[model samples]
Target: MSGATILMLVVGAIAIAAAARRYNLPSPLVLVVAGLALSFVPQIPNIELNPDLVLFGVLPPLLFNASLDSSYLNLRANVRAVALLSVGLVLFTTVVVGAVAFWVMGPSLGWPLALVLGAVVSPPDAVATTAIARNLKLPRKSLTILGGESLLNDATALTAYRVALLAAVGSGVSVVHGFALFGMAVGVGVAVGLILGAAAAWLLCKLSDSLVEVAIFLILPFGAYALAEHFEGSGVLAVVTAGILIGRKMPKMHYATRLQGGSVTATIDFVLETLVFGLIGLQLPSIIASVHDRSAAQVTLLVIAVTLTVLIARIVWMFPATYGPRKFSKRIRERDPAPSKAVIGVLAWAGMRGVVTLAAAYALPLTMDNGQELKGRDLVLLCAFVVVIATLLLQGLTLPWLIRRINLPVDEDQADALAEAQAAQQAAQAAVDRLEEIAEAELPTGSTIVDDLRTSAESRANAAWERLGPQDESRLETPSELYRRLRRDMLHQERTVYIQERDSGRIDDEVLRRVQRELDLEEAMLDR
Candidate 1:
């Protein structure tokens, strides 16, 4: 790609990324739409960047960020289900797809080559899965399984793809050798990740500077990926492992350093998420260039085949797997209740394919083992793109509606509100305890005076919490309503000031944006 073409693509990608966030749409969808529009324009100069760069470079940071934000405790508790879905389901899909493709398309492509296509589409995208799950608020077990499985499934499928490719290239694959490589890949990746995570954690703990800490956090994902690849391990797995480890270790680390007057880790996550989505969208031009000249019939067939295989494979495998486990667990534990069949159906439909599939398809080799140019590489890329679009748009948009239809139980923010009230009561009690210490030292030596004052303060805080519970206390009796009203008024005042500053020529647009963001954040904390 020319420098000018690259520059234009980057600029276009930024605009699309900002628009996607503003409109509350999936950023990748925005990127694809934008890319499709740009492609039809005359003289755009087709962009050609390395597929490896898009997969490893654009992907690891995104995956690491997803893993870091995931709940470690939830993942640990649901390890069995996650493993069954991630490893077992990925392998099963590959087998089913390989068999079907080989049986149906073997005349056009050899058996081994067909298998490679299957491997490419086996793992769902981490980015798409997490983005959808963020809105669903499924059970902790289900969410953890989905999130954890997405993180690890890519490494497994990619490793399998590499092995299958090597076999096709006459490298003479052995089961023993394959197992050995898999072990080494996981082991070296875990070791490197832990070492890097420890070092990063130590540095962040020691440093009081927010910008420096955020910078260090940014470097760690790429560093882990590069180091693992250098050692012949799965770089993707290493980045994920390091993220999980570091995230678990971070709560104890004082992330108190102010970055634009906010927690450093939170700032880092925001910057990384925005940039990653932007980059994912930016990859559109190159992906389109992979498919330049295909007949309409050929294109339609490829898209239909890929979409059918991906959608069917998930439903066929997941229904059995989800139910089998629930039954087995019930048998083993005696009191474990099975997930309702309706809930399982919702989980099955929730499997949205995304960036990882597109990345893998784009990463396909230009030439095959016999040195003849790969006939269907473009078709594969196009098919993968179709799968991503179909799953993300169709499933993502419909999932919330499906959940409501199923009538699966969920708290709908009431639980969170109650927890926040409980926590506030505890904090207020501690504050009262500290005040008592001060009062004892400074008071005029009247015991009843101090006791009465402390009791009254405790009663007010407890009353707020009591209103949150199942009690029938009148709303007027709860001081929380007053606090809530006061907070709302304060937030309104801040919002008005922000608008005034933006309207006046006193502050630049960017400064006004920053100030407005602060106001929004303060407004958000009013609930807590």
Candidate 2:
């Protein structure tokens, strides 16, 4: 890509994404649509998604960000569902899709090539699924299942893709060998991830500076991916492992680091996801150009047949995957009860594919073992493109409607507010105890400072408790809300004076920045 195109891609994506957010539209879907619309413009440059750049450069951070935002607690709670979707479901989809492709598309896409296509599209896009989940505000359990499934499913799909590739390239792979390869990838990937996650946690703990700590956090994902890949493990799993470990460790770190880390990661996700979907759309012209060998009728038939199969296959798998284990295995029945059918139906519909399938299609070997161009190479890319577009357009657009119609049994937001109140009350009590202990040991008992700290803690806790009380406009402001309102005005005045001091040359820019940060933190707390 040229500099102009790069600039256009970044700027266009950001602007489009911003608009999407303003309109409450799915940014990924909008970006993809924008890119597709832009692709036909002769004045616009042809945008090529380099397979290596995407897999190595693009995939790791996106995977890591998804995992980082995920809840380790929620994941552990729904491990069975996650595993069923990530491992069992991905393999099942591959076999089902591959068989159907071979049977329907004829010898043009033989068993090996058919399996390649299957593996490419087997896993739903992690980036896409999580984005939809957060936007839809699905129940906690449903969100956890979707997030966890997306987080781990890429590893399964990619591993299967490699095994299929080995067969496709005439490396003479057998079923036993393929299973062994998959096993090795999973084992090694997890091991590398755990070791790296521990090391990253150590490094994060040692560094107090939020800036440097976040920088290290930024570097670790790519490093974990590369290191794991170097050892012949699944890079996807390695990055995910590191993310979950780091995420769980985050609560122990300084709040400043947590605040800064959250902002940094959110920004990175926005930029990367916007660019990814935009690229997905822009490749329409090139992807279509590559499929000169296939007739229009043939391409249409394949696209329609495979797209329907991919959608239906997930719906078919969810029933057995949800109930089969609980019926047969006492462990699953005891630990993890089956989710409602409505929830399972939502999960079945959330299978929109994205960048991974596209990148993997391009990652196919350029030539066969005999040194001739690989058969059906363009066909695979075309199939991947069509499936991605179709699923994203069909499923992504209608998912929200489906959720509303099904109405999964989620408790309202009041449940979250009540939980916060309970935690806050306990925290306040802890603070009071600590203050009393210190006062007895060092300061005279009932010192004004101790009294003030105790009151502050109580006020913070009571504000939370007040959320459970009357919230109508007719109600008076609680002590905490009143303090927040008046204090915010005072903070604004303090910031104005600081800026004036800087403008009058009484305080240097550095001093002004330091003072402004303090005021900003106070204001942010009030806003929260």
Candidate 3:
């Protein structure tokens, strides 16, 4: 595509997202619908999703950003559930869906291509799930499981896709051989990811430059992915691993680096999400255009069948995967009681296909190893596209409604508030002790300075505790809240003066920025 077209696409997706927010609809739905409609316009080009660009160029960052936001501790806590969804359920869905597709499409489609289609649509998309789920007020554990599953499931799905592709190209892969390939991918991918993650963590710590540190994080995901894939391992897993590791260390990095990295990551995430979903929509026209020889009825039958298989397979897999452990193991019951059926219902319905499905469908080679055209490649692509849209429309649109109507338990905001208050109190006490120790050691701790410092720490702790109190607007403004309000006004004045000085040529832009940043940090602490 031309530069003009790319610019238009970005602008259009942003517009769609804005409109989606205005109307309280999901951005993914709006983007896909807009792209599908635009695809039919006579002036538009036949923009296809390039498999190599998406898998190599686009996918790594998307997965990396999601992993960065994910809590390593939370993922570890829910590892069992995530594993059931990501690894076990994905493989099961691939076989069940593959069996159905082959049985329906018959020998013409063949087992290998049939399984390839299955693998293509097997996992719920990380981008889609994260995009939609985070907005809704699901339980914390539910969010963790969904985020963790989406992060790792691509590894299982892609590995299956790779194995199936080998079979399709007549590489003579058997059940035993496929399992061996999977084990190798997991082992190698994890190793590469850890080695790269450790190197990145070290570099980030050693480097003090915020720009350079942020740049390292930005490049690390792509490099890890490429390196892992070069060794015939899963790139998705490698990128995710590196991102999670780096994210955990972000808090320890320089504040400037944290702020810069966060801002850059959020911007990239918004732009990429909008373009990708819209691109998926633009695909419908090309998918339809490719089915020249297949009869309309046959195409219709296969699309519905495959789409149903994808939808139903998730529901079938999730309920058993959820409750089976609790029923069989007494320890499991005590440790993790079963969630309400309503939560499980929502989980089952959250199975939307996206990036991997779209890229994997297009990634198929034109011909097998023996040089014959890869039969059913067109149908596979068609069915995969149908499944993607069908799930997005059906599940994405209704998810909010289902969640609201089900009255799912929300995260413990009150408990979280209490924890914050406790932590602040303890930290304040620690600070006070350190100050006394410094004063006793004959540091520049004047009586007035020490008193002011102690008072500031106490005020911060009081602000946190106030949140857990009554929140009536009629309540009088506490000293802490009043102090914050007064401090914000002071910060504004300080920034105004700095800008005025810069405008009058009394100070350079650098000086203005330095002063403004100091004021900004001080102002930020008030809110905390």
Highest TM-score model number: 2
- Give the range where candidate 1 is weakest over 10 consecutive residues by summed lDDT: 255-264
| CA-lDDT, candidates in order | 0.71, 0.88, 0.89
Clashes within 3 Å, all models in order:
0, 0, 0
Report the Cα lDDT for residue 18, model 2. Answer: 97
Candidates 1 and 2, the one with greater lDDT: 2
- Residues 124-193, candidate 3, lDDT per residue (tens digit)? 9998898888798988999899999999999999999999999988899989999999999998889898
lDDT, residue 230, model 2: 90
The true-versus-predicted C-alpha distance at residue 452 of model 1, in Å, is 16
List the RMSD of every prediction in angstroms: 5.1, 1.8, 2.0
Candidate 3 TM-score over all chains jointly: 0.95
lDDT for model 1: 0.71
Candidate 1 accuracy as TM-score: 0.80
| Full-model lDDT, candidate 3 | 0.89
Q: Taking the tens digit of each residue's C-alpha lDDT, what string does model 2 give over 1-528? A: 777877778898999999999998889899999989999899988777888877887788888887877899889988888999999999998988888788777887789989999999899998878766687858888888888888899999999999999888888999999999999898889988899998988888777899988888889888988988898899999999999998888877777788998899888888888888999999898898898767888788787777888899999999998999899999989888788888888889999999889999988988989897788888889889989998888899999999888777778578888999999999999989998888899998558998899989998888898877666668688767888999988998888888898999999999998888888888888888
The sequence of per-residue lDDT tens digits that candidate 1 reaches over residues 1-528 is: 566755665666667667887988766556655655655667655554455755666677777777777788878767777787778878787767777666655556565666667778888778777756776757766677788988998888887787776665556778788778878888888888889988887877787777777677778889999999899888888899889987776676654432332344444444444443344434456656666765676567656776787778888888777667666675634544566777777778877876677667767777766787776666666666677777877887788788888878765457766776677688778878887798878876767777887776776566556655546545453465566688789778877877787788776889877877777666665554
Question: Which residue window of length 10 is worst by lDDT in model 3?
Answer: 470-479
